[model samples]
Target chain A: MEQNACCSRREHDLQRRVRAFAEERDWGQFHTPKNLAMALAGEVGELIAEFQWLTPEQSAEVMSDPEAGGRVRAEIGDVMIYLTRLADVLGIDLADAALSKLENSALRYPTDQVRGSAAKR
Target chain B: MEQNACCSRREHDLQRRVRAFAEERDWGQFHTPKNLAMALAGEVGELIAEFQWLTPEQSAEVMSDPEAGGRVRAEIGDVMIYLTRLADVLGIDLADAALSKLENSALRYPTDQVRGSAAKR
Candidate 1:
């Protein structure tokens, strides 16, 4: 499929590639929302594990170091893979969904109210 | 300051409010990368805790039930609040940053390769 002009080329491209892979192997059957969500969480956990116990400075460095960065990127890629898949499985346009969510969030958190306060709503 | 156009009105608006709140209390000095990062982690931990023991179905319900949903929203709000603040402090345009990241991801995950496959890179 050709990429959408308005959508982020990278994400849309990735989504398309991932979808084709699934189509070829007939893996959509295993991608139920629940399972996909679980997969997303698992990937997130792995991402977090990469930073566990690392100081803030150290964590920042991890992203700059080739080996550590590769791991981080790989884990992040996994999370996004599942996320994009979940979005695809549910028939959501990833870009549109994100844009809409941001729109809603703008209403929920007015800049004037949220600026620097760490106060939870 | 007025809100920026081409940005999420809600996020920019919230950021403005938060910034004003911070300015009012002179808290900018406290929002260093290290401290803010820690606060972010704490908020994330709270968000994760909300779903830790719940079954998938139960977790879904948690977001729909008024009480549970409210807590979930609060935690999410907390996370976003910190995230937005971090972006603000670092002079990032959150929407723009997201857009750029998505663009980069497209190159990394070509649609032909990624479709439907859950294979991790």
Candidate 2:
């Protein structure tokens, strides 16, 4: 499959914005891996909060409400932001890591063995 | 800032892997925006589970432990996987969306105003 040149460009683009955002405030000094990881968790919390009380079906439908959809998207964006920042601080290539994981998933849960079964194991 | 060619490549690479995997099981039909969004939320829930009981400081330190770190990494990967899948279904360009968001963030949270304060407000 051909790789999307644009995706790599975007990751690099997000990296710069993240780096510059931190640098402008001299916040680089605070972006320790531990701190960034915590931030990642926190942002994920906010993302989940948007669906805190919804039933499974409702959770699926959470976005049918414009206000809720907007919040979810913002939280999604926040998750992306912190994930990008964490990777930038750790020098991990998110795109590389993501691809590698998917490749591994392909291996771990072979189609013939895992198809029709949603369970991870 | 120069976009990283490699990052985009990885995203495309992941997309192919995702498409191939779903197609193998004929799961494409289930990839509705609502279902994908719900999956995204579920994955984020699992990610948060890794740090649920930890105090703020302990949450930051969660990854210092090898076992905990591995779990966190797995959950993080899961989150990324679902995110990529969701974006793919929605026809959203994660990289482009990410950049546009960062640009917006730069405007909303100006350095001088937000630097000293960690609050999102």
Candidate 3:
């Protein structure tokens, strides 16, 4: 794919690409929702590993290190790939799913109630 | 607040509650964007910690265990709380932010290109 082709792409598009990539290889059979969810969790675990035990400043440096940053980015991509695929498999429009959740959140966190709170009631 | 009052609320509402909880306690001063981001990362770290090295089956059990599940939920709540606050501080509508990202993804992941793929490029 052209670099520019992905430059303007959104999360769902990346997800689709990953899914298509898998499908082209006949990997869909392996992508059961449960498995996909596990894959996502694993990728997230990888992401966390990148920063494990790092001080805040070191964590910042990790993001700046080409190798570490690339690894982290790849892991993030992996998580998103599974997430989008799972959403697609479930017939969910990621955008709509996110928006609906946001709407519900708006009602729960009225400005007055959640302007700067950190504690859970 | 009444449990019933919170039962019907959304993610944004929960975020709002957390933010308000902090604000009411004069904690906004501590919620700089960087700090909030760090806090979010910390919460995510905690979430991941709950399942570190567990087998997939074990992870499922963790979620089913009331104690582990509660910790995970609390961590997730912490991440969301920081995320919503960051959105609020940045003047973003979480719903709109998520929707906008989704719209971008839809374009990128046309059905023809992304039916079941997993490879990048």
Candidate 4:
């Protein structure tokens, strides 16, 4: 699939804004791609913590509770921010990478072959 | 800043595509929000593993190596797919959530107050 021009522009705008935000506070010095990737892991850890110990049904309905929902949303945002920064620092186009990976996944796990099974083929 | 219309549409479209991908393989049963969040953590772990024990400079330049770069990109894609799926399961607007968090971060870490420092305010 072709990358949408508008999406590309918006992603660039978002990256610029994030870069500016860090630059404004001289945080760029601290934002090595390694640090950002680790930070991304930390944020994902927090996201996972939100769902920890919840029953599957409860987790699926987590957003129904305002407080838990807010925490989850905030963690999600943190994860995205760090991930975006890491991609930018590494000169990777995140959206393209994701789309390409999805395409590869589709090929690797064809529907008919993988249906109802979690085993790696 | 208001969420761009095109960005919102793109995010939703991506979410739908992810959802359909899982549904097609009868994988929805394994995709509870908790499972997705944990899977997200696992992917982030893989991303961090790529940079582990490298000097900061080497970690920063990880993508200079084609093989390492591909692994990093694939890990990033996995993280995003699981994150996108988690948000979808919980009915979260991920872009809105990230923008909101960024706005909050701006307020929490004012440029003038936080400049040249890594301290969280």
Candidate 5:
């Protein structure tokens, strides 16, 4: 019940969709965590490639450009799908993992100390 | 309203949390999409590093080992957080972006064509 507080219904649905999509194609054997992680890394690279040469202003407004926006959205989708699949395969709760990580970050970089600054704590 | 069907409540909450966290620290100026995308790339590298030397089987079972699992979970957290933040900054709906991407992939790599194999389409 406590876990449900953080985990979203659609997140689980997306995970199930990913699982079923792979299952229907008998792709489980190929979806080892290592493989998924590597796939994830490749997707991240592709995602970053979309913003490779853009200025900060351009990067911020990328989604407004039809071609680049489509590419970026597709990459985001690829990244999330792989990430969701990887976490599902590993029995990891993404919401819990992310929230706890944020908590740790908050502690590490207290607002009062880190305000207006980007520095390691 | 239609978007609500795919978007989960907690996903938005997490995005809000990410936004607020940065806002409190005045980190928005530094969170250009390019920077966030690169930061995401770095986090993916860290996630990949967690399984760098592990065999497929080892990678699958890595989460059962507390020490490695903790590190892996933390990396996942970092990756997801950066990803969520990046998507948020771009005004892209993560669920919509990812779901549509999956739909596109289904068309590109039909189950019958790519079943039980890892091949590009």
Candidate 6:
């Protein structure tokens, strides 16, 4: 619980800070869901580009290379920022959305049915 | 603060549930950080695929279409799951990582230099 509180405090602070930054700059007018989604996809592509030709073994060591690690982390940060902004703009509660989907997924991929299967449902 | 506590409590429970689900099924062996990252990218691709053919206007209305919206939300949930797991495996705190990057981005793209530029820094 203590750990969770700490996580929440940091997350909550980041959320507040992000919102304030955008608001102060009057950027919300440009943060339509579509633009945010496209920005997210572009960032995801950039992250994948870093691993495009690497063998699985090489890819696995991505974080060991400080330069690649920094790039990967920055891309991940971009992805999260857009995602959070999109969800906020849409009035979606991310935690609730995730929890609900997880419940559905838990049912969809029951251990008895999905064990040892790589098939996506 | 209360609202944040709620998000934390739910997020904490969901994290526990996800870990237990994997442990009970003995799927941890396949969940190497590289594999999780790959899976996250794939899911992000799927999410983007939904918006690929749409114009900006259509993409903005994506959520109005129940079918597309459901798929998009599910993909988002998948992305979050993989991200949470990967961060856990890497022993990185998502909130902390995001905050540090946000700080850096604020410095790199300060309003005075980059406002309304739409240029990647």
lDDT top scorer: 5
What is the descending TM-score order? Answer: 5, 4, 6, 2, 1, 3
Q: For residues B45-92, write the lDDT of model 1, one tens digit per residue.
A: 675677677776666456457786555555555555665565566455
lDDT of 2 at B11: 68
What is candidate 6's TM-score against the reference?
Answer: 0.80
Give the CA lDDT, 0 to 100, for residue A28 in model 2: 72
Off by over 4 Å in 2: A1-7, A51-67, B1-10, B28-75
- Candidate 6 lDDT over B78-117, as tens digits, reads 7777766666565555655666777887888788776666
Tens-place lDDT per residue, model 6, A1-121, is 5544323554566667777777766677677767777777777677678767777677667778898878777777776777666666655556556667778878888888777677777
State the TM-score of the second chain for every model: 0.85, 0.87, 0.77, 0.89, 0.93, 0.88
2 versus 6: better lDDT goes to: 6
Q: What's the TM-score of every candidate structure?
A: 0.54, 0.71, 0.49, 0.91, 0.95, 0.80
* Segments in model 5 whose C-alpha atoms lie over 4 Å from true places: A1-6, B1-6
Runs in model 3 lying further than 4 Å from the true structure? A1-12, B1-121
lDDT of 2 by residue, A8-114 (tens): 54567677877888899777766765666667667766766776676656765666688877676676777788878876664456665666666777888888887
Task: Give the poorly placed runs of model 1, Cα more than 4 Å off.
Answer: A1-121, B1-8
Q: What's the lDDT for all of these models?
A: 0.59, 0.68, 0.53, 0.83, 0.89, 0.70
lDDT of model 4, residue B111? 87
Backbone clashes in candidate 1 total 37
State the weakest 10-residue window (summed lDDT) of model 4 chain B. B1-10
User: For residues A1-121, could you state the per-residue lDDT of candidate 3 as single tens digits?
Assistant: 5633312234444556666656665667766544655565565566567656666556545545778655544544444455556555544444434344445556666667655565553
lDDT of 4 by residue, B32-85 (tens): 988888888888888899888887899888888999888988988887788788
Q: Per-candidate DockQ versus the true complex? A: 0.11, 0.29, 0.07, 0.70, 0.83, 0.37
Interface RMSD of each: 7.0, 4.0, 8.8, 1.4, 0.9, 2.8
Worst window of 10 by summed lDDT in candidate 5 chain A: A1-10
What is the TM-score (0 to 1) of chain A in model 2?
0.87
True contacts kept of 6: 0.28
The TM-score of chain B in candidate 4 is: 0.89
Cα-based lDDT at residue B57, candidate 3:
58
